[model samples]
Target: MQPFWNFPATAGGTINSINNAGIETFRGNELDSLTREICQNSLDAVKDEEQPVIVEFKQFQISRNQFPQRDELVNAFNKCESTWKSKNTKIEQFVEQAKYILKNDQIPFLRISDFNTKGLEGARTGELGTPWSSLVREAGSSNKGDSSGGSFGIGKSAPFANSKLRTLFYSSYDITDYQSHIGVANIMSFEERPGFNTLGTGYFTDSHNSTAISNLLNLDPSFQRDETGTDIYVTAFEPKENWVEAIRNSVIYNFFITIWQDKLVVKIEDETISHENIGTLISKLDDDKEEYCQVKAYFKLLTSEEGIQVPYPAKRYKKIGEFKEGEATLYIMKGEDLNRRVLMTRKAGMRLFEQNRISGSISFTGILIIHGTHMNQVFKKMENPAHTEWEPNRYEEAPSEAKKAFSDLRKFIRETVQQQFQAETTETMDAFGVSDFLPDTTQVAGEGDEKKESLTMKIKSIAHKKKEKPKKKVKKKQQKENFEDTLEEVGITPEGDQAGHSNDDRNEGEGLGGGTGNQQGEQGPADEGTGGAKEGKGEKEKNKPIDVDTRYICLEKDSGLYRLNIKPEKKFEKGKLEFKVSGEQSDYILPVITVTSNDIEITSIDKNVVRFVNLTGKKPKNIQVQVDYEQYCVLEVDLYEI
Candidate 1:
C-alpha cells in the first residue's frame, strides 16, 4: 500500500460568534423571484412528459392573522349561526390548503402556449411575496416545448392580483400502466399589510383554496394514454377595462411580446394576440442574421419651462390609463391585448398634448442582440441630444455592455422618431387643417452631424455660385471681323463684300470693317471722336491700386448723433470680403453699434477717425462694425454659447 499524506484543513470553532457572511436570505419580493426560479426548473423538466401541463387559478379564504382585512372582519363576524360559522370559520383553512396543494400534489398545472393543460409531467412548486400577500406558485415542466417567462411563478401572481374572486385548476397524469390519476389546485388573492421584506421571510401568507381529483381510466384498448399532470382554474379575476381584454394581454405587451415565435402562442382572455408561433421562438439566432436590440427611453411631461431643463428619470408604469392629460387618457398596448408579452417599438408616437395632457413616459424591457458593429448617431441636429429620448433604459451606473447597446439603440430610435415626425408634420402642414401647437419634441431634438454637413455643403455651393460675375455682352462688329478672317482663309466672301451695295445696305454691317483700303484707313475716326481722352487713365489705374494690409482691432459704442470707435484699420474698400460665419462661431462678430441719427456719414476721413452729424429731424440709432482677433472674439460671446 502507498503511504497516505494528509494535511489538516484550517477551521474556526466559533460558529455561533461568526457572522453569517456566505449566505443571503430570500425575502419579500425575493420569494416571488425564487418562485420564478423554481418555475423555470419545472418548465425544463417536462422534456418527455406524456401529457401537456395545465395551469389553474382559484381563490379561497385567508387566515385571520395573515389577511390584511382579517381583523376588521373578525370584529364584525364575531357572532354567527352554525351554517354561517361553517362557511366563514377562519382564514387559516385556505393557507393550509394552498400549502398542502404545493407540497403533496405530484403534478402541477403547466402553462404551454395557448393550449395550457391541467398539469404536465414533472411538476414543481415554489413561494413568493406580493405587495398585499404571500402566494404559492406551481408549474409543470416541459420536455419538448417553448420556454415561458411566467414559469417562475411570478407570472402566476399576475392573474391572482387582477382576479376578483375564484381561480381553478384540473390536471391529469398516468404514473403506472393503464392507471391514470388527476389532481387539481386552485388559487386566489387576499389583502395583507405588514408583509415580508427583501428577504422572503414574512408574517403574511396566502389565502388559497386547493383540491385533488383522481380516477382510473384507459378503458379502450386501442387508445393510448400517457404521463401524469394537474389542473388549475382562475375564476372571478377582473379583466382590464374595455380597451384591454385581460391582464395577460398587458403582460404580453409589457414583457414577453418580443419573444413571439412559431413555437410560442399567447392569448388575451380567449383571443390569440401574437403573430409568431412557439416553434419560431425555440430556434437559435441565425449566424448571418443581425441580432435584436433593446429599446430605452427616459421621458417626462412638460407644462412649465423649468421642466425642460430637468431630465426625467422614471420607469414606465405597469398599469395603463394612469396618465390623465385632460378629459381623455392615453393607453399603451400591443395589438389588442395590453397584457401579452410583446416587442417594443423603436420609437413610439402619440398625439400627447391635443387631448389636454402634456406628456408621458415609457421604457422598454427585453434581450437585445448586439455585435462589434458601431451604431451611428441620429439627431434632429448634430449637436442636439434633447430632441429625443434614446435609450428606454439609461442610468447613472450601468454595465459596459448595456451602456454600449443602449448608446447604439438610442441613436437609431432617435433618428427613426425624427424621420417619422418630420414626414408627418410636412404632410400635415400641406393639408388644410391648422395645428396651433408645438411640434413633437422627440422628432425635433436629436439631429446628427450627417444632416448638418449636408446642409452646410448645400449652403456653401449656393454662396460660391452667387459670387461669380455675369458674362459680358459681345458686339456684332467683332463677330463679323472674325467671320471675314475665316472666309478669306477659305476663299469665300459675302455678296456685299464681293460686289457693291447702297449706303443703307452697307451700314447694316458697317462696324465690321469689311471694306477695302479707304474704309480701313478711316476705321478709327468714329471711335476716336466718341471719347478719346477718357479711356487712357482708367486703363492704367485698373492694373494697380495701393494695397493696404492693416488689420482692425477696435470697439464701438452708441452715441446721440453718430457712432464712436477706435479705428485700427483704413477705410472700407469696394472689394472688401467677409470670412465665413457659422452658428457655432457666430458670436465672434462684435456687437453692432446702433446709429442714433440718419445723418451718420463720415464727415472726416483719416486713420482712426470718425465724424458724422444727425441731419434728419428724428435721431435714429447709429450702427457700426467692430473687428477683433480670434482670442478676443472667444472671450466676448455669451456664457451659454460656450
Candidate 2:
C-alpha cells in the first residue's frame, strides 16, 4: 500500500511564498483572470496535429471512499486541524471545511479538464523543461518557449487559490508515452506535524521516494476519463452562487478572440461556449453596461478594419532608427466604455496591461495589439510578477538595442494617438459649426513646402492688433439702422425691422382709410385686403419678391435618418416659394418631410424643388426636415419667389 502523503522538507515556505507572490495581479475580475489563465495554458499545450483545444469545467459530488488513500487523507486532515493554532478566520474556516468534507460520505469537487492537446509530458524526476517537473516540482521556472503564453509557471497557483482546501489532483495521459499519470497535491497553510520536516506540501502516490504518479489505484475508474489530455480535480471546491454564469461570462469576454479564431473550444458542463452563440450569452448580461459595450465593440472592431495601424521600429542588429516594420492595431473607441488607458496585448491574444500611460480623455477606450516576431522577447523581460505592466526602470536602463526599440515604439504610439485626437477634435468642431465663428486652423495644402509663421506668432500678432484698435461709442438708433442695412446687403430682411423701419412706422398707414382712396367708388385688385393699400415703404418692400440661397442648408445623418436644417439667406412675404435642391444623385432617396409646424404648408413636390407656402403670409421660419436614406448626402437649397 502507498503512504497516505509524502511531504517534502527541502522546499520549506514555498507554499506561502508562491501563494502570496502577486496572485492579486489581476485587479479587474477574478473569474476573468482564471478563465484567461486556464485557456492560455491549454492553448500553449496544443499538439502539433493542428487540432483545436477543448477545455471543460464540471462540478460533481464524490464520496470520500472514491479517493485511493481515503483513510490516510482523513487522518491527515484531522491531525492538521488539531495542531493548527492560527487565529485567522479564513484559515480556520478552510480547516473546518476540509475536515467536514473528509468526514462526510459525499463531497463536492470541481473538475477542469483540457483535451486535443499534448498533455503534461516529459520526465517526472529529471531536470527542468519537462511538464511534470516544471508544474509539480519547480516554482518560477521558465519551461515555456517563446511562443507559449505562460513563462513564470506560477499560473498553476490559480487553481490552488480557488480551491478551499488548496488541494487538487492532476491526471494526464500522453499519447507519445502510452501511459497515464495521476497525482494529488495539497498545499496547506499550517504545518502537518511537529519535528516531521513537513513543509505543508504532500502528494498521494504508492511510492514514497518517487514524485511521479503512475495510477490512482482504486480511484482510477471514477477519476480517469478518455485516452489523452489533463483533468484537474479540485477537492472541497468553493463555488459562489451562480458560479456557472460567472464562468460563462468570463470565458466569453476574455477568450472570445481565441474562440472566434476557432483555435479553442470552451464548455461548462453541457453548455458549449463558442463565438457563434456568444452574442446570446452576452444578452443575458446587462447590455447597457460599459463592459458589455466594450466587449461588443472589441469584437466588431476586430473583425473589420475599423482602427488605425501604428508602425514601430523593429531592428535586426541593434541599429537606432533602422525600422524593420512591425505594426499594432489601435482601436479608439467613443465614450467612456472602458478605462482611459491603452490595453496592450501580444500575439497570444491575452491582454497584458489594462492601464498603460496613454494619457487622453476619459471618453476614449482603446485596445492596442502589438504584432511582430521579436515583441515576445522584448515584453517577456519587461513583464512584472503580476504580469500587469512593463517595468519602467528596465526600459530606462536596458541595453541600447532594447532601449531604442522600446523608446521608438512608445514614441510612435503616443504620437499616433495624439494625431488621432487632434483629427477627431477637429471633426467634432466642424460638425458643430465652430469654424464659422473662429479662424480656420486647417493647414493649407502645399504650405509645408513654404516658410510660414508659427501659429503662436500669428495669434500674438492678432492680439496686439486688437489691443491697439480704438473703441467707439454709437447711438442706439444708429446701431439699429446699421444692423438693418447690413441685413439688407446680405439679402436677409430683419424680422422686427424692415429696411431701417420700425414696427410702428410700418403699421402707420394701415387702417387710415376704410378703402382705397379712389375718387369713384371702384374695387381695386380683388386679392387686396380690406384695409386698402398702405403705400408705405414696408408695404412696397413686402410686395417685392425675395430670393434665398439654399446652399447654407445643412444635412445631418442620425440613426438611419437625415435631419435637414434649412437656413434661408433671405425671407419673403406671401408668394410662390421654390426650394431647389442641388447636388442630388441618381441613387439618392428623397426623404418625406413631415411638417412639424402649422405655419408652413406644402404646395407641390417636384424632383428637386419642394414648393411650400407660408400660411402666416410672412417670411417662413427655419424648416426641420427628416428623411430615411441608404446613403448620407448633402443637398444645397436654392429658394426662389415666383
Q: TM-scores across all candidates?
A: 0.25, 0.59
Q: Which lDDT tens digits does candidate 2 get at residues 1-642? A: 544566556435443422345244543355556677788888878875365688998888777777557666666666556555464555556567777777788777778888887777863443467887787667677587665677777787677666656667777776555344445554454455554435556676556653556642223334556656777777776666577888888787676667776777888978998767766675566777766666776665555455555555445544322434664555665444444455667656665765444442323556666655456656665666556666645543455666655665565655565566533333333357766777555677777744444455334443334545333222122122233244455453212111110111111111110111112211211111111122232442122333331211223344323223232334544332222122422111243444344556666443333446665544435455544443444442323342
Q: What lDDT tens digits, residue by residue, belong to model 1 across residues 1-642? A: 111111111132211110111111222222232222222323333334343322212223222232222233232212112113344334235334433333332312222221322233322222123201112222322122222222122333333332222122223342322222221112211222222111111111121222122333221223233544322333222233432222232223232323232222234334443434322322322323322111111111111122112111222222211211121111222111111111222111110011110111112111111111111111101211111133323322333434454443334433322232222323333534444453433433478544432223334443335555434322222222233354466553222111111221221111111111111111111011111112334521111111222122113212211112111122222211111112252211232222222434433221111223323323222334332223222111100000
Per-prediction CA RMSD (Å): 29.5, 20.8
Q: Which candidate is the best by lDDT?
A: 2
Worst 10 residues of 2 by lDDT: 508-517
- After superposition, the stretches of candidate 2 with alpha carbons farther than 4 Å from their true spots are 1-3, 10-30, 86-92, 123-127, 189-194, 215-224, 279-285, 305-313, 316-324, 327-342, 354-366, 392-404, 417-642
lDDT (CA) per prediction: 0.24, 0.54
Cα deviation of 620, candidate 2, in Å = 54
